[model samples]
Target chain A: MHRTNSLLTELKKNKMLFLMLIPAVLYFIIFSYLPMGGIIVAFKYFEFDKGIFGSPWVGFKNFAFFFQSGQAWLLTKNTILYNLAFIAAGMAVQVGVAILFSELKGRHIKKMMQSSLLLPYFISWVVVGSFVFGIFNYEFGSLNTLLKGWGMSPVDVYGNPSIWFFIIVGFYLWKLVGYGSIVYLAAIMGINPELYESADLDGANIFQKIRHITLPLLKTTIIIMILLQVGGILRGNFDMFYQLVGNNSLLFNQTDVIDTFVFRALNQQGLDLGMPAAVGLYQSAVGFIIIVSLNALIKKINPDYALF
Target chain B: MAKNKIRRIDMLIFTIIGYIVLGCISILCLIPFLLTVSGSFTDDSSLFEYGYRLIPQEFSLEAYKLIFQAPEVIAKAYGVTIVLVFTGTLLGLFFISMTSYVLHRKDFKYRNKFSFFFFFTTLFSGGLVPWYLVMIGLGMKNNYLALLLPHLFSVFHIIIMRTFFTSIPESIGESAKLDGAGDFTIFARLYLPMSIPALSTIGLFIALTYWNDWYPAMLFITNPDMMPLQYHLYKVFNSMQAAQIVAQKTGIPVAQMPAETFKMAMTVIVTGPVILVYPFIQKYFVKGMTVGAVKG
Candidate 1:
């Protein structure tokens, strides 16, 4: 009775704080948790009239069709591979640029370069697609013009399936590297200046100080970021891939990731809604499991770095 | 002696590794933009004659002229994007700050429960398909509300704002409470003024989202009048005939057309505002991230 009274008293004391949180609570309920009720559409036939719960149940049929499409394997491979490549390449570029930007002392030069570099990130992928089309179109492409001037042959970058992987990767790096580097630079700046000053006073030069200090310090931030990204590895970046390669079917072999495949199979064909939902369910489940497990591992290694 | 020797060795190796990596990454960041920008200025006739380059042998303002002629379409897009950015940023900042203020209050009855409610969305979502269905069900299709409503309230920004708010001293609320200030009054007068840096970061993020959003426009906005600037540029570059029509309208010489350059020029033009203001934005991004990382 006494414990219950104390608990009630505590709740009463903090009532205002909780009251303030009501709108945010309502927001999530409406937008997020409620939509989870629609996940049932994955298991059902998804009739328009019947609605999510009302739709007829078809046990694992959606899963079966999703796997049978043959696009399942292709798209899964494309999505995972591209993401792995992006994560690996993006990490390398960002860390490298960040360390360099940190080492340079010229504030003006650093600011100019950082701003110039970050400009591409501000533009939408739709605009990026236009830029790609402008430079790569067959007859009027700048590549062809330059090639002719140099008495060299102009290759059709758009038609060539092999060339797309490089172009898309380049585009991804161009749009993201500066922003990612900025994040890392901020992390580096947060490192105590005293650590560097002490090392310099002890007659340590720049390379020795960085090798001893910088990389070790950035490890936790890097690990957390990596784990966060790896959770969504199964999900493709629809905007970048779709905008750049959407209309061009020939390039789909190399470029078609899971998101695009689902979009086409579901939206374009008006085919089985169940399969795409099942695919989405699979992606989410796998992603959730991976993230949880990864967090567990991180917790085991260093509880401080674990997201949860 | 051992520590000093080790430190020197570490510095040498680190500098070597750091410099080479940064140089290569900087080039990677720089070269493509240069190619695109310089390539844009190169004559289209010359472009077909030669490949893209770091510098243009012959320059023409054809692309600029063509784009400038059909200024109405582009102008409308710009207006839509700007209005969305302004409205979304203001609304988002208000709601986020208020919500965070409530969550941060120690006397809130169900603060943890509410936090969980918002935080869970980030952890688990119904994926894109269901969200699309919900939008369609809500009659948001072809509606401007579709663009604004779906993304107006961000859980991430709320979390950041709450984190910043939690760092504020409790005495503030106590003093305000003593003065008989209502929850809204305290939030508006005391908390909002103190959280400028955090607000700026969140506000800028909201602004950028509205500005850079072609996704919402693509899915919901089929009307040409509703198309945003980035999407307008998307249509222009995809079809050369669109460019030619603009050229015809503008009365620019056909042979002097810089179609490729115009697309590049458009990219430069649209992103110019962001480039100019980025330094100011960066300061807030750095501060907000630090606060978020530490509190979170």
Candidate 2:
């Protein structure tokens, strides 16, 4: 009774704030929470005539189909491996560029280089796909035309699946290195200048300064960034995969992730809703566990970096 | 001294390597764009003969002319994109900022609870199938709302905006309250204006997301007339119809048309505004990234 009275008083006191929050509350409820409730579709035999709630419950059948199909392992392996590659390559390039940027002397050159590097980030992946096509297309592609000019046989990139892992990672870094570097650059900037000054007084070389001071200070930021990325390691960048590889089944073995698989199963495979939903639920549940456990780990290590 | 000489050499080597590395990466980043532009302007026969080059072998405006010949298609796409970007950015910025404002209030008892409420969505979701069903259930198919709604409220943006608001002195709000100001008026008259840097950063991020959105359009919009610029470009790349229409409108035989060059031109046209304005707005993006990194 006392708690109810206090809650009423608090509600009365902050009526406008509560009112202002209603739209966000409603938005989240509709977009996020509603779908969360809809995860039950994974366990059901969904019919078009009957809604998600009305669908007949078929326990574990959808999951059985997914696991039995052998796609579950492939998708999981591809997603984790590709994300690991992206994170490793991306961190190296981004950190390297950030260090170079901080060391470089000319302001104009730095600005120009940074701007040019960032250009690819602004363009859509579809444009990147077009660029890839322009370079790799068999007849009119630059690669084939150059090969033909050199009196060598033209190689078919799209026909080859093994090369796509490198291509995907290369493009991911190409688009994101500049953007990612800015974070480390900010961290580098935030480091105490007096440390550098004292090092200078000690006659420390630029490389030593970077090795001893800059890198050490950036450790926290890097750790936090890696942890953040690790949390979403299961989620594939659907835009990049879909645009670059598209409906080309030839490359699906090399490039397919959980997202594209779910997408194909939903749109292309013709109404096998339960299986896709089951895979999605699996992805979400694993991703949720990863994030929660990682957050706890981060909290134990450094409370400030913990997402929660 | 020998040590001084070694130090100078080390600095020299580092400087040279820095320039070389940064220069090469910049050129690699820029070469594709240059090739696209040059390819778009190259004559069809030359493109077929020599492929894309940094400089056009035979300069021609025919591809662009073909695009302008059917102006309505590109114009309508630009229209849809513009409307979506403007409406989505404004609404998204307002709601995001408002929510952040409430959460940033030091006195708000439920701030942590609300923050968690938004943040939990990022950790898990019902995945695309249910989200798609939810949109379909809401009758968002073929609706522009489908495009606008999904990119509207990002949890990341909310966190960034709240962090920005936290930088503001709380005494300002406290003083405003003493002067008979309601929370809404204080937020509107003071907080919104004070938070322009954060606002612009988030606004540009939201605007860019809306501008570059094609996934939502692909899922929801089936009508050709409803396509945004990026999706339209995707269609042009995939389908021959966009080129065929150009060929028909210009009275050129489809066999003789510059379909490849036309695709490149369409890409350039679609991507042109972003490249043009990127230099001016990128600092804000960098600022946003840094700000998020600091507190995130």
Per-candidate local distance difference test: 0.75, 0.91
Tell me the deviation in Å of residue B92 in model 2: 0.8
List model 1 lDDT by residue over B1-296, tens digit each.
87778766765676566556655656666665677777667776676555567787778675566667778757887898888888888877887788888877767655677777777677677766676677778788778787777667887788788878888999988888899987778888998999887788778778887877777676677787787777666666665655665666677765666656777777766766776787677767555545555535
Predictions: Cα RMSD each: 4.1, 1.5
Superposed model 2: Cα runs more than 4 Å off: B244-253
Please, what is the TM-score per model? Answer: 0.87, 0.97
Error of 1 at A153 (Å): 2.6
lDDT of 1 at B39: 66
- Which candidate comes out best when scored by lDDT? 2
The residue-by-residue lDDT of candidate 2 on A150-216, one tens digit each, is: 9998889999999999999999999998999998898888888999989877888989999999998
How do the candidates score on chain B by TM-score? Answer: 0.88, 0.96
